[model samples]
Target: MENARSGNAGKHKTRASIVEVAARLLHEQGTAAVTTRAVAQAAGMQAPTIYRFFEDKDALLDAVAQHVFTTYVAGKRLVEDSDDPVADLRAGWDAHIGFGLANAALFGLLTDPNRGTRSPAAAAGLEILRARVRRIAAIGRLRVTERRAVELIHAAGTGAVLTLLSSPPQDRDLGLADAMYEAVMRQILTDAPALPADGTTAATVAFRAIAPKLPMLTDAERTLLSEWLNRAGDDPASFDASHRRG
Candidate 1:
């Protein structure tokens, strides 16, 4: 029985490996390149085995997309105990941009029509962000209309990061992404009361504003973003121009 169990685990791993490899290839090359026969050859598994895991090319692609997005949200840092909302929020946005810019291909894959299903990963991000927003809303700093803030924040961040990733070296800079994020946060928080006199709570408010829209993540691209967090809001190409990158 133990041997049988081990065999099952091994089979699961092999299937997972195939999914990961196929997702990468599709992201890097495109769906046409990831034929069942090619995946079988690459994974060193038979084509028949691939069929056992996925019904057809479309099924495989859907699974890959779900896996990629799910992985991206699982890695986010949603602060629970922090007193400084603003700084925390900025940190969260920076992390999001870093994740998206570094893994733009995965972002493309997850957002692609062929792969846009909301998996556990995308839902997880929304859940985390929603929780944080609820906390901030409790503070009276966030207005009722501010509920829409989360969507706006994500749109801004995703748009900015996509720009930075696609721009030329002379035009590309992650700092620009940070700036764009900050501008949006300030606009959102402009009407709110000043934070705690000590400033930590106010900072926390700022943090909460940006925390929900953390980054564009997909399981296909797992590398986390560190540099983008530290620099914080340096837009070289300018906020307007960064949005124009193809």
Candidate 2:
């Protein structure tokens, strides 16, 4: 048992070392420089040794991308939530834009449709955005459903990054990201948190956020409330028409 444990630990260490080395090559020299031979040479290992841990070059690149992105996501998660959830959301957006600009090569890999569609790291990032949007919804400030808010933010961020990256650094508009963020905010957020004391849309969005957690209700009641709130949140007109006859 001791020997088996030691062997597994050794394998983990070797794999991590290889991944770190590949990640460095990918960063310092871009994706094309991360071939198995280059990574093995950098790690001071035999090329065949890489095959023991990774199936192929693509597999190694995937692991490297995961490693690099996991570090970034961890940093994003470490930020403490402030009193203003809207501010927190804006901070997260800024952090994402900064990361994309700093890690251009990794960003390309992450945005590749072929790989991104199945990337756990990409999914993790999206989940973080959802959490941020959920907080805004809970505060009665979101004008849209949580899903729509997330999609709009994600699309805006991607477009902002790609547009900035396409330009020369000196020629790039420094205000583009902030402008895009403001545009998304205008589309998704209300005037202020709970400002209109009698606003239906804000209250409906807030209620939808907390409906499931209302302990006074049974599971069936909660489910029904959720469905109604979903309708109300997604389309207020449909919600009104559906209940008008009743």
Which whole-number lDDT from 0 to 100 does residue 167 have in model 1? 83
lDDT tens per residue, model 2, 201-239: 667888888777788999988888888788887787787
Error of 1 at 145 (Å): 2.9
TM-score of each predicted structure versus truth: 0.66, 0.94
Candidate 2, residue 231: Cα displacement in angstroms equals 1.1
- Please name the candidate that would achieve the greatest lDDT relative to the true structure: 2
Which candidate number has the best TM-score? 2
Alpha-carbon RMSD, each predicted model: 14.4, 1.6
* Deviating ranges (above 4 Å) for candidate 2: 194-199
Q: After superposition, which runs of candidate 1 have C-alpha atoms over 4 Å from their true positions?
A: 1-7, 26-33, 77-81, 143-146, 168-170, 191-246
Scored by lDDT, model 2 comes in at 0.87
lDDT of 1 at 233: 23
lDDT score for residue 2 of model 1: 100
